[model samples]
Target: MASIKTFINDDFLLENKYAQELYHTYAKDQPIIDYHNHLPPNEISDDRVFGNMTKVWINGDHYKWRAMRTLGIKEKFITGDGSDKEKFMHWAKTVPYTMRNPLYHWTHLELARYFDIYDLLNENSAEKIYAETADKLGSQAYSCQNLLRKANVEVVCTTEDPTDSLEHHQAIAKKDLDFKVSTAFRPDKAIFISHDGYNDYIDALAKASGQEINTYGELCEALENRIAYFDKNGCKLCDHGLDKMYFESYTESEILAIFAKKRSGKELTGEETSKFQSAILLFLSETYHNYGWVQQFHLGALRNNNARMHRLLGPDTGWDSIGDFPQAEKLSAFLNTLDSKDKLVKTIIYNLNPADNEVMASMIGNFNDGSIKGKVQFGSGWWFLDQKDGMTKQMNALSNMGLISCFIGMLTDSRSFLSFPRHEYFRRVLCNLFGAEIQNGQLPNDMEWVGKIIQDISYHNAKEYFNF
Candidate 1:
């Protein structure tokens, strides 16, 4: 019998020789532009020294939490009061069951890439790998900033709310680190008018902007104030996570009345909520355009599905799923609304459902207008769709409908420090797609041009698109 090969070798996912060449020669060395993620800027600023694998890998990682829960592991070892070692052990036992899932690939890839440990994670090897990582993580070389450096990350943008002070970002700027850290303004809280704590959040926004919110007009003013502040602080982009685009028509008086009723703790009718969300979202988008900032909309998430678990663990604890919202008409109308006023800035639209890949792919071309090279983008597969099959479908859709050559490629959009290997995963997948097409004679065997295109998708495109 033949012996089993190494699980995560250099050409792990590169299938053909051309695929291997493209990845190694072009895609491997490109510095990553993790332009969107939920990594806490405070950790980077403080250069946090995480003490163990549990701290760096498992802590607050809903990806792992979801896996552990699916494997019949109890909440204690997953997210509750279990000891860190216990949690790491539980994770190791669960790793073998994750085969064929992206989590499995991500798990071993992170171990190999970050720790230089090529051993597959499982029950047999868990304790040894766990101890090895614990020792390295406890050392100074594994500090948060140093870990980012080890990944060869050139620029990374962490998301922040409108009310954020960005003190950590400021501190990082003060230090001149090798990598650049930036902020993207996320105003989801402000747009979510009918959410549970809208009024209280508005009050916080009021304090953040030094303006009292008494009317719909005043609310817009406060948001604009925050936008100006964010722009002054070197913000080049903004992000929105929504079920779908809202384009409901509303008069100024109607929006004002709705804001007043909500502020007074009155319940808003569904129509009233839609109108308010539409108005605020449009206002924010226009302001982003005026400031020449790229805007990203992560659409189609049905959040907080399991009410009991959600209430127990709070948001982003993995109770969310892809929402099959009707996207095209409203999304088109929303972008057209801004385009009619010539206020549509550089835009990226990410769809969570793979079924809408074609819709999103075609939607971007409607507004490309040749003013910029791929100005509006059908973004890479996101959220539930960030895996191999989903990414392949997204690239095929974009290549068929638009210019994949101009594509600004992968982002972590993750909360864990160990998630940077996701970029490598994306690059390998990207190269294999191009290489297969070359082998099939769909295009000439022009390795030079193909290599350039692959490299651009890996790094240069995002850098030029975001101008980071």
Candidate 2:
């Protein structure tokens, strides 16, 4: 027998017996409601088959690419210019270095669940696993549609650009597929003008909305038009990615002046830029409130700092890092800005820094008026924290600070179908926590109550929250 097979049989879910039982009860039949992800609508529309495991798993996942780079693997092995087989080989070489990272667990879980192969990926087993996975890829069961079905995904909401046609989304909606996938309205490109391509983006927005872009008023109108389009297509959520919340206010004249300067091809000072962005966020938030849509903010990421790598490889090529801002105070002020005006929409705050987990968790409670106990939620562990320790910390913090029963569960936040395993990971962690409490007599061993809580977090919470 293979050494990997021995490890799987001896230790898989056995490390926590209560967890094993909980998984059997809650996880196996749960329907996945992925409320946030980066899956392209076109692929889902096509119901495509991945050419191989490498393309499905590695092609666009910056997380794996970052790890590969950290291991001194050449760019060719990453997004650059390598063959699929070569990239897989490089990833195989880097697997041992993952060690205690969540990536290690995620990789092994994927191997066991999908391919039913228990080989630890290393130089020795890399070729064998690769060939075996490739062989399976030739079957219809391994197509992207089949992969999603096998994961038991009931719905997925893909993050989309403001300028997107959403033709692919419409196409998928027309299909007979079981999963009800849709798009979330993401308008960060229109909001962030500090980047080099602001002018180009403004032009694109004008074309998309069929409105002039000479003034701030016109810009707001154009945005409203796009938002309306998204709403018409069953969009009930809006997503924003920012370093932190902006609560600063600006006079109409000040914002209009900044717009004029930009329209005239003149650069605004940093203060002016901040005012413009802050004003735009306020406008957009109010729009969300009017539509009764949930607004999601993925905060505290410092993106594109590596100018050299960014220039060479383009954006989202792993040039981003975490930012250390006093997120709690600013974030509170931002929410309060809306709350005070009675214009706050349903909101979820996701933070990148783990140290701020407790603070972020508690911050959500401050805004929860008796209207909804968990209405303002601290979203699942996101980005860099999408692993075991991170998920555990998030769940513990939310449980300690607020009612975990109201919590919406895990989302992939991934660009790959293989990432549905993330839901499985979250389920295992959740069950372990509940099981431990029961075993330690922290809670009565009423399996029925505990099982309901588990199922609620796993599926029911998201279902009710997102209204999917």
Candidate 3:
């Protein structure tokens, strides 16, 4: 008789013996360095215990919310006042329908890894899984901090706005825990002059930095003050989310005039807006170089497509998609500007549009002056492209265009603590790719050397890159 294989078996994503050995030997047991994510710092600081599966899994997960909405589940059960179990049951019903979507694999992976409930989630199994998970979640062993420990996380770097207090990160630093927590400075609001409530956000930033900003110079000073504060508090990186890189030319006087106009609640022309954005982005990058911080740009997201839903539910509620922007010209100009000035810090650029995979991969090579290993990197696939196909294409592009051995591997980039399994998912995919190549005689049969490379991509490279 043949043995039965579970939906998420030991060899779930591994297709052959080489893949299994590589994963189990080199990829598994590697500590995670989640260098970029959106997890709430307060929960980790407080060590809060999320008492049920829905609270920990379904709530605030726009990924699940989007899927539920597509399956015609009502908003009440998805994101509104419905009971926790009700939302989960609705999600469970949508799981089978999520087949061929990354959600199907992610859902089961999370379930099996976190809750130890290996049975596939459906309407019939929902009740049992929910009850079992709720019981486990209600324990002290499942607190926010413990959840991270379960995932073997070594360092988790969360993203924060310029105005954030970072008191939670400060608090976490004092703890004697096994893992470390860091933050990334995200000043997108400060650079986006055309966004709604931009002035209001400026006011908040002023308060946080303890400086008044009536002029463009004052604005730069305020941001610089905050960067200093973040650096003092152990922030090692910064992140930006943009439709595309901004590289329009402008004079200081022009930028100052644009700032004055926007601050006075006066509308500016498209040219003025682009010029202001370009100037501020340049200023921030220069400041980041001075502080010796890594800079990351996540480009090509077409956010908030559903205006009506956005008005009702707010941003990041899963109304975003990939954007088709002319990335190369502006991106090349922007990086070249920094490189020419000799002020380019270690940089990673992530793209959401699959069409720009090779474009971004090749673009990073121009400015990689070899002062450091993988100095300017085409970052891993992000947002909509975090799936298996997306990750594969990104690695292939980088391998063909640049060096994959020095690639800083996966990050959760997720809001949920349970999402750490994504690192494992990425590792499995990476091992299978190399393992298949070895099997086809595309490369020499050197398991030791290949395994070492796999380990670097899995864990060591990021450890060296970030110095964490």
- Please give the range of 10 consecutive residues that has the lowest summed lDDT in model 3: 1-10
The TM-score between candidate 1 and the true structure equals 0.98
Best by lDDT: 3
> Candidate 3 on 167-202: residue-level lDDT in tens?
999999999989999999999999999999999999
Each model's lDDT comes to: 0.92, 0.86, 0.93
Q: Estimate each model's TM-score.
A: 0.98, 0.96, 0.99
Model 2 lDDT at residue 108: 83
Q: Deviation in angstroms for 431 in model 3?
A: 0.5
Error of 3 at 20 (Å): 1.0
Superposed by TM-score, candidate 1 places the C-alpha of residue 434 at a distance from the truth, in angstroms, of: 0.9
